[model samples]
Target: MDNNKRKLTEKELKRKNDFEKISSEMQQKGYKIKNMTINIQQANFLGPLSMLPFITLTFLFYHNVNGFDLGEISLGFVVAAILFIPLAILHELIHGVTWGFFAKNHFHSIEFGFIWSSFSPYCTCSEPLEKWQYLLGTAMPTLVLGGGTAVVSVMTNQLLLFILAEYMILSGGGDFLIILKSMLYRTDKQESVYCDHPYECGFVVFEK
Candidate 1:
């Protein structure tokens, strides 16, 4: 830890304690912490791996639903691809906005920054939340931006929008991966709260 780093709040401290306890139990059960860290290499690999199925399904579904022709790449596709920068920012904003609502300090508890080495933008909530609230926040961008845009693309027969939506969904692979890990190892405890890791792309669970 850096000496100049901001001190954790009392709430954050308690959450950290709980997280450490859960981590100890998990380690005893053979879980490795390294497996949960979301670094640049993992993102590079998982992004495309997760996107293959998403792109294929979106293409097929839109084709079947609207009878839309899969057309050749055009200038419009290029434009949409360029728009991914703003879209990525919006995706992080969505996470901040949704998760901020559940935090005790609201937006003050939310931090948005980029990992320059990974070229990834992230929004993290410092406060702890119930498992369901955390899940909802994690899934909101995928559900709203990804799935919603894909639905609209199907309705409007826009290939570019479909591709864009698939890309957004793919960007969420890290979130889904963390959720999957939690589900696999989490105990059935009602007091469990999920806290987004301050310096990483995953979450830590704390149970009272």
Candidate 2:
């Protein structure tokens, strides 16, 4: 039942095989690995909103013109600050696209949130992905979304844009951290088949 549409390198295939073996062995050895439900909606909204503070901070503290500032204290940086919202949204979109492409009909939901005081986005898939797929899906948003924003900001010489991009890259959190943690634990970096959890088989998380 494997979809062979995407080609995996030998090293990647080996890692996936090893992870499956470990998960199977662990289960037979009496270790429990349970799947958990993830709330994607929460991630979608919160992820974009997380950039609000940076925008607000710029307007409040850096604006040069004021009066009807919509509670904003500054306007000098308005040109660059507004991009944060869209940039955050793009972050989620990248996660969605990556998950959607790999998992086909396995999409569950999307969440946006200030999770643990950090902004992030994520998607729920039907099953755990291969380790390489999981890693790529999680990192795609940061590189494509955050990195793209940063690159464009630099090319355009927009300071506010740069700030927003940098903030999203730094504070956005989700499956990226899970991937890092999984690596450290020497466990399957990707969720095993039929698993569910925040970092389970069917989902990829992204930061704002």
Candidate 3:
């Protein structure tokens, strides 16, 4: 989408300024700053592609441990499928709730809305936070909603819950993408922090 060529509006400029102000303050406080750009197009495309392994694993687990029957699809299955919509929203809420605590503005610093271009919802924090804080917030939805659901599915042997859990995990492709990037590009510095890019789909990291 040629993110570098994209022009910033006044509001975006203000957001950038505010984000940078926080970064500058951190730098002055002896933290080194690094920025990461997330390409929405790439993220959107890769998020689903990255789910291949998870989907395969889920299928294998169901087939080997608990036989999966296609005939199981019924009215209940339809109802469970409908829950995806709310779960999508819940995914973003998880991000906000986890990250908000670390932000100076608390819940106020968290923004939730949809990205029309990608047709995806997002939850972003306006404040800078420690690297671990950002990681925890980013991973919470997958760990709790996705992983937790999977455990329940395994225990109860509910195919619907298993499918839902796998879907949730697959849907978290973008979060994992960011986490992977953070880890790959991480610095050896002892102190590090990360914040969302004011106008982009990804985050910026500060390390020292």
Candidate 4:
């Protein structure tokens, strides 16, 4: 009996040590998560405005360069712009669909606004996810959107298509960074800034 008691004590000690290690790791990761969130937020403000300068520069390039066909600007640019919105919607849907494959009861949501993404793209399950599943769900959109855009851009050789892809990523804003951290967290089991309250903003909720 004494031997059995000693073994049990040893097991308990091991468990305690492991739990403490995990807890400490979580805290450190949480600090990094908060910092990343701040960076994403800061980019949200500056990135779009920075594009304005790029736009001005694009115009300057257009003007200073000779043989710029003004006719190329009209119908083709309008058609490409019209197609960009559906591509954007498909990007978000890829995120929702991939998440559903893992969490049988998964649900997702999206929000759109004039300025930013409005912060309600969500993936909720019956319980907190295994780290890998969470990471896959988070990273799905950028991969789908980015890769899709690249393939289409190559096939079409369309400059506007490439710009649309960049716009989709930039519009994702903080969420893109959140996705990156979540992907890292899968390998490292680090804490990340995930949506605590997903329904506060107007969004498209998805369910599995």
Top candidate (lDDT): 3
The reply for model 4, stretches above 4 Å from the true place, is 1-43, 46-85, 106-127, 180-208
- In angstroms, how far off is 202's CA in candidate 1? 0.9
lDDT of each: 0.72, 0.49, 0.80, 0.45
Scanning candidate 3 in windows of ten residues, the lowest lDDT window is: 71-80
Tell me each candidate's RMSD, in Å, in order.
Answer: 6.2, 12.3, 2.8, 14.5
Residue runs of model 3 more than 4 Å from their true location after superposition: 1-4, 7-14, 73-81
Kindly indicate the candidate among 3 and 4 with the higher TM-score: 3
Q: Encode model 3's per-residue lDDT on 1-208: one tens digit a residue.
A: 1336777766567777788788778878887656687777898899878877877876677667777767654643676678867888999999999999888889989887776655667788988888889989998998888888877887787888887887888888889888888889846788767888888877887777
Candidate with the greatest TM-score versus the true structure: 3
lDDT of 1 by residue, 1-208 (tens): 1214546655546545655665677567654443344564676787567667776887789878876443534644676678867888999999999999988889987877775555767787877677788888988998888889999988887777777787788877777766667677746454556777655457766554
The model with the greater lDDT, 1 or 2, is 1
Better structure of 2 and 3 per lDDT: 3
**Per-model TM against the reference:** 0.76, 0.48, 0.85, 0.46
Cα misplacement distance, residue 118 of candidate 3 (Å): 2.8
| lDDT score for candidate 1 against the true structure | 0.72
Q: Specify the poorest-scoring 10-residue window by lDDT in model 1.
A: 1-10
Q: For residues 166-202, write the lDDT of model 4, one tens digit per residue.
A: 5555555444445444445332333432331221211
Model 3: per-residue Cα lDDT at residue 205: 76
User: Model 3, clash count?
Assistant: 0
